[model samples]
Target: MAVAPSFKLPNVGPGPDPLSLSALAADNEFVLLLLQRDYHCGNCRKQVQVFADWYDEFHERNTEVVSIVPEPRERVRSWQEEYDLPYPLCADPEAAAGEEYDQPVRFGPLGRFSDLLGRMPKAVLLDCRDGDPTICYTHEGSSTWDRPELEEVFDAIDEQR
Candidate 1:
C-alpha cells in the first residue's frame, strides 16, 4: 500500500494543469510527492517551508518536488505565495486526492464529525522512469511536529539513481 499504484490529480500551481502518473517519468525523471494537512495547520506550513528551502538541492539531483493539500485552488495560491514555494502545487479541496493517496485524516473529539478532518503530513518518492512511475519510498508523519528527515529523503533519491 505504501507504493502508489497510480494516481492523478489536478495541479493548482502555475495553471490548471493535469498532473498524471501515466506521464510522470516523461515529464520529470522522478518526483517527490508531498501530502500536506490543510492550510489551517501551522505545522503543515512550516513543513512546506522546509521543503521550499531544499527545493534547489532536490532539483540538482534531477528530482522534481511538488506538494498537495486538501484546500481550494485559491487558498493554495495564497499558501504558495506565503511560503514563496518554487514547486508546483496541487489542490484537493474535497479531500479526494488525500483519500486516494491513503493519507490519514482525523475528525475531532466526536467521531461523528471526524470524516472531514484535516490531513496528516506525509511524503513519498516516485521513480518515474521508462514511462512508468514506481514508489521508491514512503514517509509518514506520526505527529503534529513530525517531519521527514532531509538526509533520509536525499538517501532515497540517491537510491533511485
Candidate 2:
C-alpha cells in the first residue's frame, strides 16, 4: 500500500511560487495530482493534453488537478505557456517530491540512459485533511507509457464526493 507524503514543491507559476497539495485543498478536499515524466516524453505530453481538454469537467466535480514535472524552472515555465495548462504546474528538477511520493523510475537499460530520461510517470489522488496528505489513489509504473486512464483518474476525484 503506497502512501502520499506531505510535500510542498516549488512551482513555475507566477503568484503561487510554491504549491503544496495540503495547502491547496480545503478543510477536507481531494486533489487530483498528475505526475509527468519530463518535458521529453510524448506520452506525457499526450496525457497532459488530455487533461487540458477535460479541465472543465474536473473543475465541475470540484476537483483540483495539478501536475508535477521534473524539469528546471525555465523549461517548466515555457512548458506552462505551451500547454496553456489550466492547472498548477510545479518544478521538481531534483526529483525530491518524486522520491517522496514513491514515483517510479526505470531501471536497467532505461535507467542507464540519463537523469532526465529515466523518470517514470505517475498519477495520484490525494485527500488532504488538516495538514496531512493521504493517498486515495496511486498509479506507478516502470515505463513512461504506463499511465492511469483518464476515466480512472477522474473517478478517483469523484470518490471525494
Candidate 3:
C-alpha cells in the first residue's frame, strides 16, 4: 500500500474550508492538479491556460482539473480573472499539498535548477475506491505542457474505460 504523504494546510476557497486530498478524491473524479510556484510568471500563466483547454476536453469524461498555486487568495482571484480559467484556482502558500505530492513549488528560467525549485511539475491521476484513493499515473518534468508521458496517460485512462 502506497501511502500519500501527509499534508495539512489551510484551504483558501469560497465554499469548503480546509479541503483534504481524501475528500477531494471521494467522488471517483480524476483530479488533475497543476502546481505552480509563482502567479506572475508568463510561463505559469500559459500553462494554466493550456490546462483550462485540456479540462474542457476532460470534463466530458467526468474529470476535474484544478490549478494549485503558492500565492495569496487575492492574487489567485486576479489570476482567475485575468486568464479566465474555467476550473477552480486555489492557493497553497504554505505548499502543504505540493509537499505531499513532492511537486515543485517554484519556477525560473534556469529550469529545474531554479533556486525556488521545490517540487517537480507533475500530473497525478488518482482513482477513488470506497472513499480511499489509488494513484493511477504520474508525470513529472521540467515543463508540464510538453511532457511526452501525457499521451500515454490519456491512452491508459481510455483503456480503463
Candidate 4:
C-alpha cells in the first residue's frame, strides 16, 4: 500500500477547525478522504450527503470522513451551509492537495483551466492506526458519476482490521 498524501487545510467544519491529515490519523483508525470534482458537481454533492447520513456508522467503526473540494474557502463554506456535513469539509483552491493524491484531470488544457470541466472524483480510504497513514483502499473514478459503494469501503476497513 502507498502512504497517503498529507494535507493541512482550512476546515469548514462541524469537526476540526484546521483539518490536518496527520492529526486526523492520530485520532482515528481510518480516515476516508473524498476528493471531489468541484463545488458544482451534482454527484459530488449527493455523495457527500450520503456520507453525512452514514457518518454515525463510520464513527462507530472508528473512521473519519473528510471531504476535500478543490475550490476556495468561501466556496467550500457554501457547501457547509447547504449540507451541514457531520465531518470535515476542507478547501483546496490551488488543487495542491488534490494533486498530491493524484486526483484525475482530463480534457487537456480545459481541465487545468477549469476543474469543473475536467476533474473527476476520487475516494481514498487510509489506514491510520499506525503513525503514518497508509492507503488501504482507493476508487479513482473514470467518469463524474463513478464512485465506490459504501459497502466496498466498509469491507476494506473490516479486512484491514
Give TM per candidate: 0.84, 0.85, 0.72, 0.97
Each candidate's root-mean-square deviation in Å? 2.8, 2.5, 4.1, 0.9
Cα lDDT of model 3 by residue, 39-119, tens digit? 665666877777676765667656666677777777777887777777667777766666677774344445334424444
**Cand. 2 TM to true fold:** 0.85
Q: Candidate 4 on 11-66: residue-level lDDT in tens?
A: 99866778899889989999999999999999999999999999998999999999
For all candidates, what are the clash counts?
A: 1, 0, 3, 0
**What's the alpha carbon RMSD for model 2?**
2.5
- Model 3, stretches more than 4 Å misplaced? 1-18, 104-119, 143-153
Q: Relative to the true structure, how large is the alpha-carbon lDDT of every model?
A: 0.74, 0.75, 0.60, 0.92
- Which sections of candidate 2 miss by over 4 Å? 1-3, 108-116, 129-131
lDDT of 1 by residue, 1-161 (tens): 14456756667664337676665567777888788877787877887788889888998988878788777788887887787777778887776766776676556454223423545678888887755677778887666667788999999898778
Winning candidate number (lDDT)? 4
TM-score of 4: 0.97
Higher-scoring candidate on lDDT, 2 or 3: 2
Clashing pairs in 3: 103-119, 104-119, 104-120
lDDT by residue for model 2 (53-158), tens? 9988877876677888887878788877887888788888877777787777666567635545677888888776544667878888667678888788777777
